[model samples]
Target: MSSRPRRPAASSSGVHLLSSTRVITALVSAAQLGEDDLVIDFGAGPGTITAPLARTGSRVLAVERDARFVADLRRRFDDRPRVRVVHDDLRTVRLPRRAFAVVASIPFAVTTPLLRRLLTPGASGFSRAELVVEWGLAKRLTAARPRDLESAWWSCRFVLTVRRRVPAECFTPAPRVDAAHLAVRRRSEVDRRTSSILWAVLSAAYARPSAPARVSLQGVAPRRITHRLLGGLPAAEVPAAVWLALAQTLAADRNVIPPRGMP
Candidate 1:
């Protein structure tokens, strides 16, 4: 029998190569890929996850910043026409104009920035993503009430959840903390107008995150509606759904113009 190909050593760039084929397979399977889908493997370290993603017959864009791994990934997937290897920084890479899904075990560092590229409101054609991220970060992202403004904004347009926890030993040169499988899927029901309105509301509320919702949202909505929706909760503790409802209420009313200058 042929021995499994050896994986390269971990790099200073925070690439922790998943050591177990079983774990890699499980991550890919959760993506539910097929021939018609387009998928991206961010930080495609030595093509471990890329290989299985290709097997699903989905068009795979294996993006890696490291030159050595880019070369190795090219050579490994050369025979697979469906796999396209792109050497670029994940943070700055241009996302697909067409609909796409992401299935990746990203580097531990730069997790937040990378996700911002994919999940930020108005990001083009991002349908779903299954990411392996730091456990603490995952918990914060999937919390009942988003602690930060960005997480709250992201939750408005996508559903963020922790699918499962992955042990540290699953990777080479194990990380200090365990990781979690984070699932993100865009909210199909949220239209462009709703997203824009939510961004406005969330930005205003989070501007004074510690303040009571009524105070933060003062001029943005009617006192009766704001009080009815938010009650006594602090702006930071207000759920994304409530934010969305507030935006929708504002959108329905012709008199209330949504706050301008969305970032």
Candidate 2:
């Protein structure tokens, strides 16, 4: 996005800072920004990572909602054409159109929502994200190899990784719990719209995990894949790849026969 003259949006006082310089170095090093890369410093409070990001030769868009922080950022990078300070709420603002990397210590409350926006499948222009967020969420994002139902769907979209643990003291008003840096790598695109829809089925199944997989999948899985011929297979009994590759597609096939046996 082009650099525009911005006015302060609001006064800044209460904001979290990724205070340690070592962490900043780690984040930037991991981002491995290129000269042509467009990087977003989301919730760029007082431009903590902005200066270093600019020095990396990549164009930086520092978005801070607070007017005071915006003013501070502009003043700090007054002569640096590479850094454009934007005064807008991170949630409502439109991100850049070009492929980009994000390295930010954003508002912890908006962590999931922000991720939902940038990491949604078909969400173009995002190559990767290295964000400092709540520890529990970071763990969940990278927990399983295929992770959860959400990650399974995202597996078609991006790679998720949990980096170093960040101490709670890294902020002004320190959080009660610890934090961590989570990285997301974009996956190569393919025709996975049907597979993507299967994620909703998986999410519903997992929502009541204690229920037998057969019972959980009953409403979502097609009868051809669930009948007596297929037997009484529990949800846990079936591999997700089967759901992605067979169930739906097989349901559409006219020549296929439903199983005749029961579990």
Candidate 3:
């Protein structure tokens, strides 16, 4: 219940209080958290979702990048022991090595990077954590569009549930298009290390086979490797050890085609 209006909803930019609070409520209910759980609310604008999340008796960390919003939150919930307001950008902020749930209101920008870091290897990914995020499904990404999300295929187990229509009037500065909520959870146990390892191996395979070349500053960046780019893997990069591990990972789905021919 912090009554603060932040941005506009895509449906109609009428400046209503951030109604996206409901999305947070849905996420909490779905997670069925316990007292020992830690719930993170990234991009917490003015503690709307943060305050409610704290009521669940779980330790809540509300992360906001804006300085003004941070000061306001500190003043609003200073006495709440269950809540801690962090004034830092989530992209660079080092999240706790463990948490029960991670949720966000889905700012239009940075969704891809957020997913990449959360799904990436090491301690950064949401190991054994439930993740809930909201996104705009109405916008279609074309190569002509500045940013293309077509290459990003959601995990098979992930599910998208559309909520009530959110009007543009919901925010201060309305976005150009309408938005929808996407609730995503990994149905199976996934090894974060394996995911990262696959990313590295598959990316190297997709690069065009050209060699005996000097170290070029214009070399392809490490992040370009995606599921779409896995088909054209280089033969030299496919070692036995890496392939064996990949085979085990892909064995669960027999239809999977290895980036490299089976040795």
Name the best candidate (by lDDT): 1
**Model 2 alpha-carbon miss at residue 243, Å:** 7.7
Which whole-number lDDT from 0 to 100 does residue 29 have in model 2? 89
Report the error of model 1 at residue 180, Å: 0.4
Cα lDDT of model 3 by residue, 195-260, tens digit: 443343334433433321111101322223222223333323333333324424554554543343
**Which sections of candidate 2 miss by over 4 Å?**
1-13, 145-152, 189-263
* Candidate 3 lDDT: 0.49
The lDDT per prediction is: 0.84, 0.69, 0.49
Rank the candidate models, highest lDDT first. 1, 2, 3
For TM-score, candidate 1 versus 3, the one ahead is 1
Residue-pair clashes per prediction, in order, are 0, 7, 15
lDDT of 1 by residue, 1-263 (tens): 11134565777766677776767777888889999999999988888788878878999999999998888888888888889999999999998999999999888887889888888746488899998999999998988788888888888888988988989998887989999989988888777666777887777788888889788878767889999999989888898888878878878877766555554
The TM-score values for the models, in the order shown, are 0.93, 0.74, 0.60
Q: Of models 1 and 3, which has the larger lDDT?
A: 1
Model 2 / residue 62 / CA error / Å: 0.4
